[model samples]
Target: MLTLLILISVGLASAHHSGEHFEGEKVFRVSIQDEKQVHLMHVLANQVEVDFWKPDSVSQIRPESKTDFRVKAHQVDEVEHFLEEKGLTHEVLIHDLNKLVTNQFDSLIRSSGHSYEKYNSWEKIEAWTGQIAAENPKLVSRSVIGTTFEGRSLYLLKVGKAGSNKPAIFIDCGFHAREWISPAFCQWFVREAVRTYGTEIQITNILDKLDFYVLPVFNIDGYVYSWTKSRMWRKTRSTISGTSCVGTDPNRNFDAGWCEIGASSSPCAETYCGPTVESEKETKALVNFIRKNLNSIKAYVTIHSYSQLLLFPYSKNYALTKDHVELNNLAKAMVKELEALYNTKYTYGPGATTIYPAAGGSDDWAYDQGIKYSFTFELRDTGRYGFLLPESQIRPTCEETVLAIKYLSNYVLEHLY
Candidate 1:
């Protein structure tokens, strides 16, 4: 039995090592000098296996914008030569991605137990949700909303004082599997809510007036795949019929402007929109829950990373939302509060104009469902580390983000009428 256990351990280690195919891969920060260069880059992306680290997809790239993309080691020379041929100026943001991946987990070994300063795996986070809820019965509670494609329980924590039919703000993280920091912030937010229930004035006031529905990780299957199979995996883990692609982009599986823009129809594409609207089980579950509680949920906040943007509705088109003035002012105020801590700046505006026209996003869908204060937060270090943000920065990132969320929650509370 001991020998069998040793063999299993070796096999697991080998599997993990095999997944680190990004060794020596370089992330290039390319500056789009003109509109033509954006088109050229899109063409280049089609001809190669380059992964867009910022702006998400090639369609979002624009003139005068700085785009970050990752290219495998073998294609580095070819990509560099192609960029030179196109006369585009670019610099290497990450010289070796594997080195950063290695450094990201170095602090984990020094800790005696689970530490919020370091990124925790899905299993750790799953266990944490129950433990936190059990420990703080009055201010927190946990419930499984649904199950993932891989059969993992999707846990949602309710953080607030026990009350009847209180207005609530819905916040979710880890929509993309590889965005470890996203889930980290969700966990930190819950911890902050529970830890500061009575001690902190803003948080206490917000909790007294509102309930926070926090989904720590949305893409459970893909999140697990990222931990065990590939560190850079995005999308869900459900297999589509007639194709080998494993997952759909949950953010693009919503009903609002489904698959219309900034999304891909190809199953193999990173931004694959899925076979149909709400095709993925995870998205369907979220939609059902939100639709069931549409009356009480006033705001919808979905968190993402590596862009440092706070965006509002109308992501499917350039048309302004009816609540444009109110949403914009709220975003600006929240961003100002975020910036006050550590001087970290955040860009705030409508999703379509502020970033790109991404169809089927949760915030846009929620707004369409009459949840007026819908917002999406792209957190931390525009593109310095991209999805591989170091563990050292998690605390500060969550801290500043908490301030922004508090500002928004307080605003939502005042205007809950």
Candidate 2:
């Protein structure tokens, strides 16, 4: 009985990670013969079977039928053409799969070698935030907006000079959980802010005028799980109420497009949206905090990895915003600044045209919530070093990113207040 109980518990735990288990080589589609079966797929040279993030009531996917997906035969370009010609709305291929995986491995090795004096673990991110706040009492302060699913404190480190309430810039990282570089960049930004305040008049001036509130790692439970088990793990670890699947992609869990268009309703998927909107505690905390600070926040930026593209809102659909032109120009300028620093290039454009149509993304949410300068940065090498970006590239990546942020910051300063 004891052994059987243990087995059941383990099976239940594994269900969250188990979606419609597909070997990386197989291309299969979930068909909704009677209903629309739309799920988000991250296109590469090949379409690997990653579970789509689904909402609560309809989390379990009872696939009406299976369709073979010949990803390799149809190259990413071919796939894009196919989707276009078919008038099918979905995430078409952008980068090749081999290059993406290879670059990810390379990045991991490279990052492992770099030595950042003040780097901290998932558990220590807040402690480090506290230390930095204490050290720079006048310019920095920390707030615990709320706790993550597993009760880890979600901290917002606000950086700026003492005085009047300034127009704020909100930046969040580690939203996908496995993108260590995102969180790393957040820490690096804070460190640089502390080091350059007095010397770099430009940075100092911006800090004096604007406040930067950064959430280093938004998905703490998933991040901790990635560190412990799977390096490629995405989404949170909150268990769904029925049918055993756990975790919802916090990114997809946002209420903006909830589970429409680019998201799936399968509990076993990678981009699984939890039981409901703001289902994940972390996302709820973020939403609550953002609602409170909405009036002050002028620009909102969320950092992610691999594609080296700077994208703007309407990720849920292709509809252009009123400020599309200005956003595009700003993105172009930011990428130019990034390239000027390290000769590294980045594509910049609207989210749907730039990459894929993603629903419920924080950037789109921020934009919808009236933050005009909402942007999402897909950082680092386009493919030579995807998610597994190395320690060695950390400095260069952070440096280039800093340049882009500075560019945007300068632009925000001129526009906001």
Candidate 3:
């Protein structure tokens, strides 16, 4: 009787664990051959719980572009049949999403120490911020920019030699919650900066002339939610009146273009623009800080994932910026430098023409504020892993990206007149 009771308890634990994740969900990559097909797919998505993995929103879908979406176990057959009936060309990218989700956690063993081979939880990262700043007093300092919706302190690391009235570059990562690799790169960058400070000539020069404002994780509440509740969570953790949804896409909550294109007003949408511009505390905090230092801040760089592209301003529209020629040339040079490390190719251009028109992006808004060097990086493998970028690739991704950032920073420092 004792053995039977123990066996029953073990069985119940296994069942409960399985129910916690996305069991049996499949990810499909569909090709949009024309505008009509894109509309049809959008209509179908409205009927079921479809999660768009790429292009992010239905409005960004275009002809000759590929779209990735996930369907739950119950809706798999219906979604597949509906696509087939519409003559949409589609294939399964991930057979079992839960398996990948399980594998994501398997790579990390934090008992040994903080390892770059795994995604660190919020608690670990918070502790790391304090530890790193304490270790490098002269070169790095930590301060709270603001508090997230859930009251978590948003920490920003100011890295440079102690000086006054120096030009600076502001970099932020982890805008979307599930993009774990985004924050990983930011942490890796801080490590690299401290590790190679005086030894690396280019890094030393950049640090000497310009301060680096690094926000390790921008969407703190959403990032915490992604870890504790949903792995696919992608917005802020603010509550809205008259709606059951819990968050807004902080990326789409900025003031540039103000939800004119490639954003949704629906509260339940993954790309939901909040009730008003800068509605999220996270967005407002960053905006306020940047505005306060507008004269000294020369550039802004926001990091994202999955698409291997470097983008500039005007993501809200096709109109070119006043400094388009210089921006394009600099981005071209930076991407060229980035490819040298791992032979990794990256496309570069204005955000709208380069990929899709995404309004209210922080990058575009920063450019409108007169930061000519504002840019956004979409990092890593195009679509194979998507948001669940494996831990194995973390080191290489950060190492190669460092080259591009340095190249751009050097250019910006030299051009500051």
Instruction: Show the colliding residue pairs in model 3.
Output: none
Instruction: Residues 69-182, candidate 1: write the lDDT tens digits.
Output: 999999999999998888889999999887776656533334434568877778789989989999999999999999998888989999999889899999999999989899
TM-scores of all candidate predictions against the true structure: 0.94, 0.76, 0.94
Residue 220, model 3, lDDT:
88
lDDT of each residue in 86-131, candidate 2, tens digit only: 4444442323433333233222221222224222357667667888
Better of 1 and 2 by lDDT: 1
How far residue 200's Cα lies from its native spot in candidate 3, in Å, is 1.7
Sorting all predicted structures by lDDT, with the top scorer first, yields 3, 1, 2
lDDT of 3 at 238: 97
All predictions: root-mean-square deviation over Cα? 4.2, 9.9, 4.3
- In order, the Cα lDDT scores of the candidates are 0.88, 0.72, 0.88
TM-score ranking from best candidate downward:
1, 3, 2
- Lowest-sum lDDT 10-residue window in model 3: 9-18
